[model samples]
Target: MPQLLMIEDDARLAQMVGEYLEQSGFVLTHATDGKAGLALLEAPTAAGLPDLVLLDLMLPDMDGLEVCRRLRALPSDAARLPVVMLTAKGDPMDRIIGLEMGADDYLPKPFEPRELLARIRAVLRRRGEAAPSARIMRFGSLEIDRDARTVTVAGEAREITSYQFDLLAALAERAGRVLTRDQIMEAVRGRELEAFDRSIDVHMGRIRAAIEADPKNPKRILTVRGVGYVFARQQD
Candidate 1:
């Protein structure tokens, strides 16, 4: 069972989402503010960190965006945690800003619990899977050695989990094509499950770190807005 942390100021909404996702088999943790969520995340856990984060952009104490920036600044080995911003603000610019701030995904408030569950599953699936090949995959200065199970950027080796490697291979294999959240989930899993999961964003985040010089402003692995992901570069 993958653990999840839900950070939102609205107690009622938090409880609703927590209960809904819990019913879907995910263990849940809740925080009423971004500061409190940050505290819990920094605290040690016997089994380690939660698999994913559900963050609310509005907070009483501090901006959720700042918290996300600080979290991503942590050492990669600390967890490579993925965050999903849950906001009521519907501005498209806000969504883009959240992505720039390192959020793996964003869900506007009043969204369906099923959509949230799907997003959670998508992120978790990426965390749990492994690369499909051992052969090194290349795209420009990036090199992902599937066999070595490692990635190299500018000839320097990078630390990436098996899931991350797998996500990168999937994108590289079909460079320039837009892969919807469902398409990515299928490619990563190599089969079908429920079509509602959002783990693809999590896996894509890992890939962004491997190849993008500035993941906050990724030039590769670009989001297709309300659809899916696209390998921003053209094929050879």
Candidate 2:
């Protein structure tokens, strides 16, 4: 499953959101403060670090922004981990600060649970675990021209939406890796949006229908059971 660590001081909100997400097929690990949250990440398992982080700006030990900055400063590959700032402070300044500090997305307090889910999905989509675009990306019969925003299927050029292009580019870039929905959204939207209002799966479904010869039994893009999605490099 896609493991997520939530660092929030409000126990009630954490429990409510945890239960809600648990029902949605996500594994929820809790950290009551920023310190513990940072600890858990510092010691990740072979399964890899938590796929995403739902962080609150206020913590008992340290400010959430400081925690985010410190994490980003880490030298390991873990620096790429995406964090979503969830806080009651709806100030635009807070949102901007969070993003500027390396947060992938920011969700304000008194927000809808559905919106949270959307943001999570968007974050995963954007973080698609692919290599840098400087690396050539190929998946089965599809070849992506990252710099050109063009796709060649079976060696022929085909038109696709900008969003679709981004989605496919992300998956192809990752190729063999499993990318969570939150990662996908983060990669696709980059650092611009405050909320991911759209569902990543729906976009993936649309992309599949267009590219997969058999959408019902997709080959290029495959769902990685409870984790998220993976774009197989080979169709067979």
Candidate 3:
């Protein structure tokens, strides 16, 4: 059973979600405020940390975006932790901001319980696949060590969320191939791309920022206009 930490302020909704997730075989730890959630995340416990976090954008004490920013600033292991933001806001900008802040995924409010469960499962599944591997890939100044699950650019470590790393790895592994949005989502998360889903584009931008010497003129992951994106077989 995967453990999940949900940082949500609405007591009633939290309870309902907790119950639903519990029935789906997840062990949920609920925190009503950002402070409490941060405290739990920072303090090492005998039980170990939760596998994933379901963070709400609206919190009582602090904005969820601030909480996410702080969370990503933590030391190695904690900083790479996967986060999925829950928000009532339907605006695309809000979702884009959450992704820009390092959220692995996001779910809008009024979503069905099943959809939440599916998202949780997908995120967990992707995280589980990050164990060290024996292969290492090199692209000019960029190096991806599968055995370490780490990437370095120009021999220097680059900062990227685990989710973004996975996304990059997926593309690099299939370099020279143009993968559609659906293909990328299915390959990374074992899920179909939702209609008008721009999360992948946001994540790709972040990946470029970390690895490309000049993100504005990226030479690694290139867009195919209406088709999708492809990782360059050759890089500078």
Candidate 2 C-alpha lDDT tens digits along 27-101: 788899988888777765333467788999989899899989988987654577889998877789988999999
Question: Could you arrange the candidates by lDDT from highest to lowest?
Answer: 3, 2, 1
Displacement of the residue 233 alpha carbon in candidate 2, Å = 21
Per-model TM-score on C-alpha atoms: 0.54, 0.55, 0.56
The 10-residue segment with the lowest total lDDT in model 1? 190-199
- TM-score for candidate 2, please give it: 0.55
Clashes of each: 10, 24, 0
Tens digits of lDDT, candidate 3, 122-235: 987887687544388888899998778899998999989877877888888766556778778777775344455498899899999999888999888888888788887554
lDDT of 1 by residue, 136-176 (tens): 66767887776677788889988777767677777766554
The global Cα lDDT (0 to 1) of model 2 is: 0.79
Q: Over 4 Å off in model 2, which ranges?
A: 45-47, 129-236
